[model samples]
Target: MTVIDFTAFIGRLATASGETILPFFRTSLSVDNKSSNDFDPVTEADRAAEAVMRRLIKSNFPQHGIVGEEFGNEREDADYVWVLDPIDGTKSFIAGFPIWGTLIALLHKGTPVFGMMHQPYIGERFSGDNGSAHYSGPSGERRLSVRRCASVKEATVFTTSPLLMNPDDRARFGRIENAARLSRYGGDCYSYCMLAAGHLDLVVETELKPYDIAGLIPIITGAGGVVTTWDGKPAQSGGRIIAAGDPRVHEAAMKLLNA
Candidate 1:
């Protein structure tokens, strides 16, 4: 197959998602519970956003497959797939926190080659494909690259919600934080945006589905960052993820994880 122009498609998709998500930012959404815990919440906004994106994809790229957080999978055997995390921070969106956003990524043969993280509430879109990462905001487009946070002790660590982790996962993350300079919470896919923007160093988390990590791959890789499972393996298959600015930092953290 010819090289698909991912940058253009992702940018258009991001803009389309913005149109669907912006009005509902704080305008009273129909929120729902995904489980007994309020921390695992969902909203009509999530479904509606995914629906909007799915329609766009089906109309324009009918041959492509889609795996969406809300809608499950469609056409899994297609040569290319789109993974969509519509409103990744659903808990934040339900709580009116404005920290939520949509994540979109294109996978070619189970590998991410393009990604977009669109924060409609904040009017920011971070995207990359074809070996380039850029952010579109009020200041126009700016190139992005990960910062060289040389060591774990000097690195910034981000995990969206510690409450989402089990005891074993929490302990694993704690062992990591105990060696880090700073640890902060909030932002789901948006945290990866921070990493790609060079404003953050590392992101570690567990129990991620494909949609959760797919959208960060291209942006992170394009920014000259490393993203993988804790064992320093490919993240596209989805599991525990650790994204770092430096390869050395990644290896050191992986050692701690496997230890």
Candidate 2:
């Protein structure tokens, strides 16, 4: 089947995952630390949501592969793969912030062809297929687009947190933050989605997994923006990503990031 054929199915996945995760939001859910040296938090909600989506995918299309944050990969060599980050902003989620969202991406032979960021608490879903993007929720549905921003000095940038970055990377990112008209922390996947929606300018992040970024590439590119590594490679594999509404801004950020 063509990639377009998967649109409705993606909606179903988002809905199912959203339903599975909503009840745990802002609740006294138990969290587990996935990292011994750092605070990499994972909750039952993350696992449960991913489990629900994985089951649906396996039942509906047994031939497909799956890669998830909570659960490991399965049949990852298959032509079609689904990359999932059930709660892209688990830290924000546990802190009772609505910035968290469910990230789902479909890759065709390792290329992202479809992506969605579903924030159930806010009743919003941002979806894309490289060619175009759309937003649907309480505010109603509309096509998504990125606003023009030509320079870092004129741009608003976001990162989940500079603290998440190591010392060298943090110093590098400080250059952009210093030049940007505005810089804010704590967005996670929502920052990328907002960049896609024309509400923001650039999003710079580091140390992201495939599941963290695979689902966001299409949405940003589809909305007429650009997403890439700091050195200008494709971002699907996820590391030191810089996304901007304007290519000029992207170039500027890349130079700063690499300088």
Candidate 3:
């Protein structure tokens, strides 16, 4: 068995992803509509970034499995699998927003063990593996931790789309909003990266698949954050995700969700 050194692999993936995304950062490209909604957009940047990562993974980890947002599953039953969301905030990237990023995660026997989120446009890379998370960029490397906010009233919260939630879910999010110190929208994968970097407190949302949360789990957990479902269970649940700087903050957010 080829035991992958997750820490080193994450550094390589970050470098490769950044190299793939930089050229397309602000270039005017034809955007394709994935859905009738204006918010559902995909661009060449998204495809190209994923393609690059896939290519690298195939070359380096030929035996590993892969699942990507742009590209579907391949070799899914392998002992090692990679979950990818290249250009995670496609809409934001297409609209010239800097919130987009490349997300990569490695799963060992169905458990996430390593992850990296690279914002190529901003030259920021957040990496985590083996219970430790770190941020790298022009500023340098720094460890991250989630906030220890004991109450929702003192928490800063974030979500991708309020519109994607159903009426009841929206109401639940509203209750969370009411309890939070502040709430914001439109961060996408970048929000989770911020959480890993200790800049954000909580990120709650519904309708996330394995790919969406896989890469984020290691990063957040490595940074001393708790990632779980809104019901306070493991985040591997397909329903919803709630990420917080501290376990207490996650529990407090859970109370608001179940309220």
Candidate 4:
């Protein structure tokens, strides 16, 4: 089936996952550390939301594959795969921040064909299909577009936290942060969506999984922006990602990042 046919189903997945997660937001939720060496937090909301989405996908498209952050992979070799990060910003969620969102991506033969970031708390949904993007929520619905920004000196950039990056990556990112007109942190998936919506200029991140980035690639590209690795590779596999609203800015940032 075509990607268009999956749009409604994606909406359903977003809704179901959002509903499953909202109640846990800002509550006295128990968190589990998924990493022994680091603070990789996962809560019941993350697992429950993913479980709901997984069940829906399994029942609706039994033949499709699934890759999730909370759970392990299943049928990963199938032609159609769904990548999910039920709470893309679990850190923010745990901090009682509304910046977290549910990330859903559909891969056609390993290429992202559809993506959406749904924030139920803020009631915002950002969706795309590589060719175009749209935003819907309390502010109403509109087409998503990136604003023009030609240079890092004139740009606003964001990253979840430089602390998340290792020493070398952090040093490279510091170059961009120092050059940019503004720098902020702690958005996770919401920062990428804001870049898609013309509100931001650049987003640079490192140490991301497929589930962390697969859903964001189409949204940024579809909104007339660019997303890629620091060395200019596709970002679906998710490592050292850099996204910018303008190609010139992207090129400029890439040079700085690689230098």
Candidate 4 lDDT by residue in tens digits, 1-259: 8999999999999999999999999899999999989999999999999999999999999999999998999999999999999999888899998989999999999999999999999899999999999999998999999999989999999999999999999999999999999999989999999999999999999999999999999999999999999999999999889999999999999999989
lDDT of 2 by residue, 127-169 (tens): 9999999999998999999999989999999999999899999
Cα lDDT listed for each candidate: 0.84, 0.94, 0.82, 0.95
What clash pairs does model 3 have?
146-245
Off by over 4 Å in 4: none
Tens-digit per-residue lDDT, 213-250, candidate 3 = 88888889988888888877777424688888887877
TM-scores of the candidates in the order shown: 0.94, 0.99, 0.93, 0.99
By lDDT: ranked, best first:
4, 2, 1, 3
The alpha-carbon RMSD values of the candidates against the true structure, listed in the order shown, are 1.6, 0.7, 1.9, 0.6
Clash totals, every prediction = 0, 0, 1, 0
lDDT tens per residue, model 1, 1-111 = 544566676677878888878777777767767778444677777888899889989998999999998899999778899999988888777778877778998888877
**Residue-level lDDT for 31 in candidate 2:** 93
In model 2, which runs have C-alpha deviations exceeding 4 angstroms? none
Give me the overall lDDT of model 2. Answer: 0.94
- Model 3 CA lDDT for position 14: 71
